[model samples]
Target: MDTCTSFKGYGRVDELEEAAFKRKTRNQKIILSISLVLFLVLIIGVVAGTLVHRKNNNNADEVPAAAINSAEAVKSVCSVTLYPDSCLTSLSASNTTDPEKIFQFSLLVVMNSLEMVSSTFPKKFINRADDPEVKEALKVCETVLHDAVDSLDDCISSIDGNQISISKITDLRTWLSTVITDQETCFDALEEVNAALVTEVRHLMKNSTEFASNSLAIVSKFLKTVEENNIPIHRRLLEAKHGSPSWLTAAHRRILQVGKPKPNVTVANDGSGDVRTINEAVGRIQNKSERIFVIYVKAGEYVENVVLSKYQWNVMIYGDGKAATVISGRRSNGTGYATFVTATFVAMGRGFMARDISFKNDAGPQNNQAVAFRSGSDKSIFYRCSFEAFQDTLYAHSNRQFYRECDVTGTVDFIFGNSASVFQDCKILPRQPLPNQFVTITAQGKTDPNQNTGISIQRCEMSPLDNLTASTFLGRPWKNFSTTVILQTNIGGFLNPLGWLQWQASDPPSTISYGEYANAGPGSNTSRRVQWAGYKPSLTAAEASKFNVESFIQGTSWLNGTNVAFDST
Candidate 1:
């Protein structure tokens, strides 16, 4: 599937005018200035980091160095973290130096607190819940609380050892962050049903949130200590077996059968189906459906923009194929629209799936930032999809998403966002950027250090389109702690020797979690890449597996429903 030879498939848009790129430098000046600054070294700050850590005796909360490894374990670790008071109140000394135990206990407190809140829900809320919608929402909360507890348990298992790798701790932090989100999820559902009820639940979950926040603070302290001491971790997760036939079940097969499952609804411009437009069909969808709703889109050129928001649960959309089914828009950030709002197609719901569909934004390079697909999807999967645009094509915006066998074409920051997403066996086509500037494939936007979000490209192919003359780099950190990994991927010669880009000057390149593992091809030579603080040319096999489909997004559990064959190995 070397996509370099032809541009005919997947609704080629590269044939757009070159004049749009000829004088593009000035157009992007403001964005480059704001989004990225020139890399400058703060010599004093770097030097200060090398000095010995000190406890501020003036501060009442600061723990003394002598108490670090003693019975005051929580206080010692709390001193370095942002939320020391929360840590002190929730955790106590057991094994001061054993970070895993400290973290496990902090999360245990969170789980236990949440469990206590749930115990009262059955006795107080359920009987009083008069609305069926409220009752359904409560059921949703019950399951979400259970899942949050399980996430905490997994975090404990992840960091059970006395000494664990930085990666494992990162995983633990990631899972812990998800626990916080789960509480928000429950509250979101409950608020939709009865906003008045949410205040009570919030009060109940307050301590649990504080405990989780404390655990994350402790983890952040460990990260800082590791950086200060230049410590290295030597552990990784065991790789799971791949290539099993059991993923595609009879349920999946039955749904995929030609014309037999028939669409629950169909959208056709010719009025051949029940609906004349995509929105009409989407409007007919039941809110918060318990069953999968399938929509068939007839072959046509749809010029209207469509948004599939959060309430459309378990909805699936499939079409004739990328070339045959086209949905295009021309919204751009230059037109005073924010990048997030300038998307032609948006999917914000959980349990959303799409196949054989093409999302395109025809705005040229001069349009600044135009997005084809913006996804705030959770446990969502896309197969055989095509995302076409000149810039910011696929906005893997938030939560978890999986794109397999998809084609994404663009120039600057095309595949960018903060979602914990994986693009497996997909084609990332790098087109030419506006003149003078080189191409930067990814721009990960992770605002919070404790967020369990990153962009993982696994076993994918990176190719250069016809006009991509200058070398392109892998990615630049849109945020200080942005995480992105290119694993077992094929990089074309067009990639720059210094395999990554930077948002701006003075951005600490070392704080980013950028790495490449077991990658091959012309652009993968580690010698030429940026020698940043956290850049790893190659990750160990076990470490690489931690970012694979299974561990990254737990892809195995949900991807099966898509009926799409994936490389599980």
Candidate 2:
């Protein structure tokens, strides 16, 4: 009945103890709350300020004395994150009580650091590096670093001041999250080409990565603070009282509400409505403040790429289902494009929502990595969307991203990235593998333990297509400390008994956090699963909850507003 299933008694959980556990948890929370208040008070007043003058206001921007009084508190907060030294150094100058200002100033510190390092890339890397292959990789790294800097600048600018709207804060978090991914991407590229070059690159770029990580940690804190403090914040979320949004009459007065969606623009192929291409419409949209700009694409196969940049937020692109609406391209890693750069449709904006659309790259598996849909959008959502490709289909690049009721089809490392993302009730289809080859569903790239990043698939269905009996596995680690969880999902029997593959045969990633809980189907057996240090057969109920949408991506709080019907439980 079992293929050498590992001993379960080591971490086996007792269900009857759950009642006592709840009582203990409540007692702990009370004790911790009282202790934190006193500890937070001790961290004030270790301060400095870099003031900027305001044209309209009489006063200059300065750190509040109250924040200075709580200096140790700030450091305590930083201590809980990944890079304490980086967080403390970057945010040392601005000691502000306002969470928004803390977020803004923390981002500014990283932005400046990235800018400084990016300026040196050309001379220090591209020209100085003797190896041609190394120089080429540096060029890609330089571009990505510059993009990260741009994303940081966008995050800082989006926060007008301390008291901005919740949507803006979400934007800030989204971009900061993207910056983390951008930094990781550079590292991934270098490591793939020559792992030896990593030490040199890390020496020069590790500070930037640390700073970006700090910014992400700070934003996460701010979001939690706001939620906990019961601060009245106006978040421009589109929630339908009736679950998924239904078509309302044009005469409805709610359409004119402050943050309601604007009139949709149309796109058609044969001389119709507003525009001929997706880019044309995307180019015309001025930042509509918080109002969502909906682009209704007509039923046609539009053969062009689309991008929603950091400056373009709250945009919705929908179409007439996957069969009729298709956006495709043929760019691939083999054709001089990095895997990240080859995505046919890229979303880097905040609050980006798409539904009933199909994004494809027809370059086939022969082209190496050809991405169909790549997203670094924070709080971004895709519902009933289809991502089609052969090798690399969808790059959930970074941030708190979610995909519900979507179809993702590919051959190798298809649904991959370094993001804390959730895929709920989606179809994960693996294509036919070549003779003597096998299929891998995911290639998670989490490198840092501090990152709240992992690929969590809950209630998702994984199946094979065509004559795909070659063999299949759940995933392989794309980097050290990689984490992925498959819970309450149905797996097809086409999968190999071993269940997972390792990128490094001689030195497998012992820190890989691979696990499956309550998964039902023929392939869900853990009998022959790898006996890695980090692989868990069944997570404790508490541990599994941490991987749920509520804990992993905190989707329960914001997913309702995405207009995508998701299982809240």
Candidate 3:
């Protein structure tokens, strides 16, 4: 108390100390408040960061591992295609890892794109076309594009939810290949009529064609993977060792196997049968009939154009003989008809069979690009038939076709098309050509390397129908990857020393897969054959077998029911 009371002039010493203490307590409170505010800020930051991390983890977990894996797998699948970028972009939206599903998506993408093209094509070009030829070609494009769309529809239906059966794949490849052919046919028609429009039309259809090509590649890869991995699939559609197609009922097989099955309908010029013309017989057929409808075309010269449309299925038409029963027409490209529409007998139905029949286009060499027998028939068989014309005699137009003991006679491109066709023990007779026009035996139109299409003349005879002053060639590559293999066949001496010819005057394209294996006769000599990059003068036996019936068309699976003789090896 005495120390506190000392030397207090302005104020008491106790009061001064108490005032200093109050000021110090105020400063401490301010410091405490600042620290509390900082701690609260730190807590809020830590909580926010933790919530963000948890949310990020949750978002990643929402994407299943399978989806990530599938996306990667899709990338891998698309990587091997010719149009990888297109393939990837098309399949980007697909979310499944199943290869089959991926393949189905590819097909759907192609289908949608094609449908768009088909719809817009007519609207874009057909109405504006001025030339009659151009207009006709556009119309033809419209038809073929529609047909292509239908084939794609069939393909999608075949694989929508079903396991990829061997038969289903075969059908799919055939139809898809046909779609490619249809696309090219449009171009070919346009090229013939108005070359100026080709570039534009092709530009318009570029996406569709590329998508189709990618789908084909993916399908082929899928098949290869399934086969290599020994994956079990529905094999019921696979060919039995000695039986017909599994879809054929016992009664149908019996009827097909018979030497002279009773006819469901008949055609005769002299009123011996039910109908007088082949068109009438075709008209009576049930649309898309599962059962084989038999038509007995008796002996007569029927001067008519017969078309078995795609809606008509499994039709078997037989005649007395090639000479006795003749269906003749005179349509030709020179007569203002497109080469495709100039066909005398057009077969567009699947499983179409003709026995002992004759199809003729009387439009001679003057009528360029006349087609006698145009077959878009899948798994079709022509036995003991004859196709006679000046140009494009046997238009093996598309799909899997087999010719056994038939006669195909023409001057230029006698046997031509994009079908995976095999001719066994048939006569490829090259008649006289127009002045300065050399003869080309085959013009395989394999526009894409992935297309499983070619002309396989196996165990056949290629000779001149008459004295040939003009030179002859085994084939000319019509498209980039045109494939024509003349294997184990006889060639006449009239063929030029050069086994093959160029499609144009330029150097032959190296992309063509032309081969001659174990072929006999003078024209088969490879010493003077064109030394193109793609021409294989002498193919090994192993390579030659790839063009056989079993390997080429998978014929064993479907040919058994037809009762037609074929060499599987």
Candidate 4:
């Protein structure tokens, strides 16, 4: 009986194996058949799309084969972007098929949409809202939308017809990125004011933002193609022993390095310099000057708001020391001021540089959202400066900014903005917040993935000012695609082991890119960091290199002129 059972079991096993083999063969055949069908369908769809595109153009006979290929290329480029439909719609009216021309057309669409939004936003929402605060926020929206339009105009002007250089692309990306930030900032202000028309305003602005995003995507694809093909073009990568900006000439570098450069204008509270106040010195500036217009402020506490207007270009302001020369204000959102207007020092001009100065907003933590220093200046540099406040201490608001050996202190979102900013050899201090308020170090606002903007905190130190702190985190995402990296920094023990916090009760979207590489100190431990989909506790050297000065901000080309120290690697 045992022998008969063993034989029967062997027979059954053989039969089961034969059945499994047959099923595997049948599945493979089905997969092959489906794959072949899908391939045929894809070919048919491409051919049909091309034919339809030709018919829409109305003159297929006049259209060259290159034009046909160009049409297909446009479809291919749009296919890979996040909003293919929007991209196609924006490019549909373009008569030229050149990728560069298509990108230009996309920018034109963005500019037109933004212009429409700028014109319609005020009429649609400002009068509808009865609250003064809401109206103020709406006004802020109008201002930013106008700024966006102006930036787009500048971008369009910079492009020499259809030809766009890599450097030009870089600048275009920066400007477009700011456009996205400006739109989101409007929404943020409206949300803060609790405007009832916030949703409507957002809806009105959605298409413009989407068009801008598509333009960014299209340009990025163009850039990638250029690089991959090794197409020779006008490219400038500034290489110098020390760091500087494009406009910083060798003479300027010498003066800055010598540390005793003669000032074009001077400011002092006492009757010792050319002017009694910084603003007075600013007023004397030659609008859009190409040379470095130097202003030396003697050591004193100037309790006045200083603004470097957009018309003032290549202005360099330095002081005796961060501790001795102080600019202080008390503007805060709690005091009915919009966050955009709350900065004690507002730098809006291009090539604005400040060294050894202290910007302070003394509104206290109770006032909420006080900004000490706000920079919208492109290619701006802050060296050995200090920003002090209880919240939003340093608003690196927009553009390419670099901060070296600076000190920033705040209770919440101390270092925040949408700029492609890097902080090297700086100190980030978090002060005690109001009861039950948590401390967050950085809140980077990168609304679009192609923005080429992020907060790269390299070789910095993060420590708390007061003891017995509540939960502290590295940062919370201010936008969906916010990007930040803490590389080779020293974190204090006060930071929560989780290392990062969500923006609200729910976890931030997976688009937020938070990375920490080769950080030291107790808080740098990744064993218990937040398990969010986008949080990267450990990154390899190659991955971290992308956030460095050279790759991140194209710093090598521009920093050679600033005479500031930077690490390209």
lDDT of each: 0.67, 0.69, 0.77, 0.77
Question: Can you write out model 3's per-residue Cα lDDT over 437-465, one digit (the tens) per residue?
Answer: 88888889998777889998776888889
Off by over 4 Å in 4: 1-71, 161-163, 226-252, 555-569
Model 1 quality (TM-score): 0.62
Over 4 Å off, model 1: 1-82, 86-261, 555-569
Could you tell me how far off, in angstroms, the CA of residue 432 lies in candidate 3 after the best superposition?
A: 1.3
Candidate 2 accuracy as TM-score: 0.74
lDDT score for candidate 2 against the true structure? 0.69
Summarize candidate 4's per-residue lDDT along 1-104 as a digit string, tens digits: 00110101111124544465455445434443443344334334665678677778765576666556556656765775678888877777775645567677
- Using all chains and alpha carbons, the TM-scores for the candidates as numbered come to 0.62, 0.74, 0.83, 0.84
Better of 2 and 4 by lDDT: 4
In candidate 1, the residue pairs with backbone N, CA or C atoms under 3 Å apart (3 or more residues apart, or in different chains) clash, namely: 36-503, 36-504, 37-504, 37-505, 38-505, 39-505, 39-506, 40-506
What tens-digit string does per-residue lDDT give for candidate 2 at 460-546?
788886768766889888878789998778898888988888876753567778888878889898888887788887776556766
Candidate 2 lDDT for residue 155: 77
